[model samples]
Target: MARVRANPQFCSSKNEWKMKNNNERTAAVLGLGMMGATLAKLLLAAGYEVTVWNRNKDKSALLAEAGATVADSPGAAVNAGQVIVMCVHDYAAATSILSQTEQSGWKGKVLVQLTSGSPAEAEQQEQWAEALGARYLDGAIQAAPQQMGREDTPLFLSGKNAAWDQALPVLKVFAGSPEWLGIPAGLASSVDLATLSGIYGTMMGFFHGARIMEHAGFPVDKYAALLSGILGTFGEFIQLEGQLVHQNRFEKSESPMSISVDATARILRQAQESGIHDKFPRYVAGAFREAADKGLANEELAAMIKVLRG
Candidate 1:
């Protein structure tokens, strides 16, 4: 359940409608980029009155056709709703429009910024919003725009209690899992970027490995069988990984058999001799050689994980 929040703008009987009206729930999304437009479509679909603002006049037209109200300017978009969602490309674009409201007051609105950026950027944007009197929340979109509105895609969130309290009810309208880290704005952003970095790093390693295998005459399509077989044992690998990592022991649990090294080194040396594969073996073998030279030769190839940690 979303925690009830008292918006600073809420006054006495004159502001009673802001507190009690169901139809009063509305959202404003600035920026009509892929992610921004996607989020606007989602809010509209979820039955919230949605308003949108985009610098490019034509950008908001599609959302407008999808039952969103397009505003001429950023301030107009924010004025149309109590909850404003900013999904610009980054901090600069979001701040460019939002900075327009600095001289004016923005006391009552809830601002949920979905711009993807560094932790420092999230923290800076939080302070920028506070200067305008708006409650700010930092949020991360863990999936592509096409995945928006899907259940459990993963969103990272953090900010003041008031901002989170007001936004949690709308999580059903966004993508996959929604994780609230803490009150500090950038905590979630840091996790999001770090997670993506790991994803890309693994992808590069997979691509490089697959390419090298193919260059050595092992076509990837044929190799996928072995790859699939290996992947099926991922849980076991992870278990062993945990044991190795925690115990600080990367010993001969899974020996690099002579057959395995002979086969791999045949490819490694062959690729190096042919100038087809570059220094991959340097990094791979360098760690193993370090272990092998250290008289840990009896330890399994998995022990290289320990050497690399060094």
Candidate 2:
């Protein structure tokens, strides 16, 4: 067990006396998939009495090897620990666990859900958990299991301030990077979904580019090397996009709508001329066209989302 002793006064706003008593805290994991397994291992490694429960019995073997106690049912799993952590597939899976666990009693226990879903759905579960006398915390892990307990890994949490403060010390063990998003459970999901979209969208765009590059006879190895460098410089996008989003200011700074639209159109045209399939670049150009059509030709590419969303 790895000892991660935090200061008693780490969360000064909360009762310092209570923080000290949080030691020897037991943790429960309701899922045994990769993400859940990673979480369970972290809790065990951090010296917590970890209880694990998975729908399938075979999934709990590795966790058992790590000195975790397996529960026969989700209710038993939650009953075994003060903190019950869940990262199941979706709302339906959550419901399956919840319906069964509520009968087993979930009073005064902290239920931290790190599952992936929309903000609205998170709130729904939060409300449902509250009705069952459980403290609900919604979280979105930005890092994978391998990054758990390591430095620079980020995880977003949102819930009641008091509950978050109470859980921080125990929760921080598995989270290299942590962001407390405030009382609303849905807020974390909103940020998470936004990030997930950008990540996947970029990957999809890059896939098309990689395919096209391979077809064009560019040594793809160099492109992978070059890709990192190109993406590494997108910090400006975060800054500019934040301002454009928060202030509704979409005035062009670097690449204007007309310029990007023209460039993307050219890329699509080139792909079409080469008898290659091109949808990603065309969709990018389509977004630019929306901004241009709105007479915001001077705005940046990020502004197109706002325009199209509007």
Candidate 3:
């Protein structure tokens, strides 16, 4: 068992006293996948008495050897700690475990769900936990297992103020600053989905660019390296574009929509000429063409959001 030590206060509000008074030195982890196991290990290393449970008991061996109490059942794990962190495959797996747990033991517990799920699932889970008298917090871990416990690791959380206060110390073990989006439990999941879209959208463009490099006989590694070098500047541009969209001020500033319109068309044309797949380029070009037709060619690149809104 890990040593129990008084957690240092991290908040300056009135809830500071309550947080210190209710500081829990025990935590329960209700999943053993890579992310879940990483969380449990971090908690244990922080000197918390960690209780862990997984569907496959064999997965608990390493954690048990590292001074963790391996619970035979989810209910047992829940009963062992005041703060219960659940990070499973999906909402379905999490729901199955919830169904098997003793509902009565949930009262007064802080249930932090780090599972990847839809906003609706998070909303529903929050309601379910509230009905059982548990403080529910929905969180999205925006980092991989190896990225855990980093000062810059992104962890978005949303829940009641009291719940946030109660879980602050435990959350800090994983992230130096856990971003509390708002009181709505679904906010974290919604942000997670939006960020995922950005990631996949960039990936689609990268794949098409890779094809272009391959067809042109250019070194793909050089292309990738160039992208890596310019990504920071590109990210700043993206942030500016996001601001423009958020403020609904799309007046041409840095880059005009007409530029992307021409660029995307050239990409599509090249795809056709090279006899490579054109689906990605076609979709991108089609969007820009639509925006151009909508008289947004003179606007900023982020004016594309107007078309997206439609």
Candidate 4:
């Protein structure tokens, strides 16, 4: 077992102590998939007595070899540890596993849910945990499994203030910075979804641009290099857009709505002529044109927020 290194207190507001004992530092990890297994290993390496449970018993074999106790069932795992970390496939799978465990086993245990889910689903799970007398915290791991245990790995967390304070020390063991978003049960999930939206939107733009380059017979490597240069300025543009949106001031901009609408129209035409799927370009063009039609042609491209908000 690894030695437990003491660290400075991260939470200022202390909650009622809920560990099994003052010195007991046992953690139960349910669902030994890539993320779950990584977490279990990190906990063990952090000197926690780790108990891991997986639907497929074989999945816990490696962790068992690493000195982790493999539990026969979710209930057994929950009973064995003061803290429970669940990283199942989704909200449904998490609920299914929880249903199998005896509700009485949940009382006094801290349940840290890292399962991917919507805000509504997260809220529902929080209510369920509360009804069962478990302290609940909804979390979203912002990094990949390989990035686990790194100091810069982000874990967005939201729950009752007391529950967060109780789990902060353990959470800090795996995540370099565990950000407390709010006391709302679903706030973490909401932030996770919003971040993913930006990622997907950027990916879609890259795909569309790559397709255009391919149609023009441009070398993909060269196109990718050019794309990287453009993307380097994206952070600045994003910051400006955010400021404009927050201040509700989108006029006198570098790129006006009329220019953006024209550029989008050209991209749509190029996509159509190249026999490429023009849906993406057309969608952008439609949005820009809609903003223009609303007399936002003189405003900055960020003025489209008005159309989107409507």
lDDT of each: 0.71, 0.78, 0.88, 0.85
Each prediction's TM-score against the native?
0.74, 0.88, 0.92, 0.90
The predictions' CA RMSDs to the true structure, in order, are: 7.4, 6.1, 5.4, 5.9
Prediction 2 TM-score vs. true: 0.88
RMSD of 1: 7.4
Please give, for residues 148-188, the per-residue lDDT of candidate 1 as tens digits.
Answer: 77675878898988888777756558954677888789988
Model 3 reaches what TM-score against the true structure? 0.92
Candidate 1 deviant stretches above 4 angstroms: 1-24, 102-105, 222-271, 277-310
Q: Considering lDDT, which of the candidate structures 3 and 4 is the better prediction for this target?
A: 3
Best by lDDT: 3
Q: Give the runs in model 4 whose Cα sits over 4 Å from its true position.
A: 1-23
Q: What is the lDDT of candidate 4?
A: 0.85
lDDT of 3 at 58: 80
Full candidate order by TM-score, most accurate first: 3, 4, 2, 1
- In candidate 3, residue 302 scores what lDDT? 94
lDDT of 2: 0.78
User: Which stretches of candidate 3 lie above 4 Å from their native place?
Assistant: 1-23
Considering lDDT, where higher is better, how would the candidates rank from best to worst?
A: 3, 4, 2, 1
Error of 3 at 133 (Å): 0.5
Candidate 3 lDDT tens digits, 226-299: 88898899999999999999999999999999999999999999999889999999999999999999999999
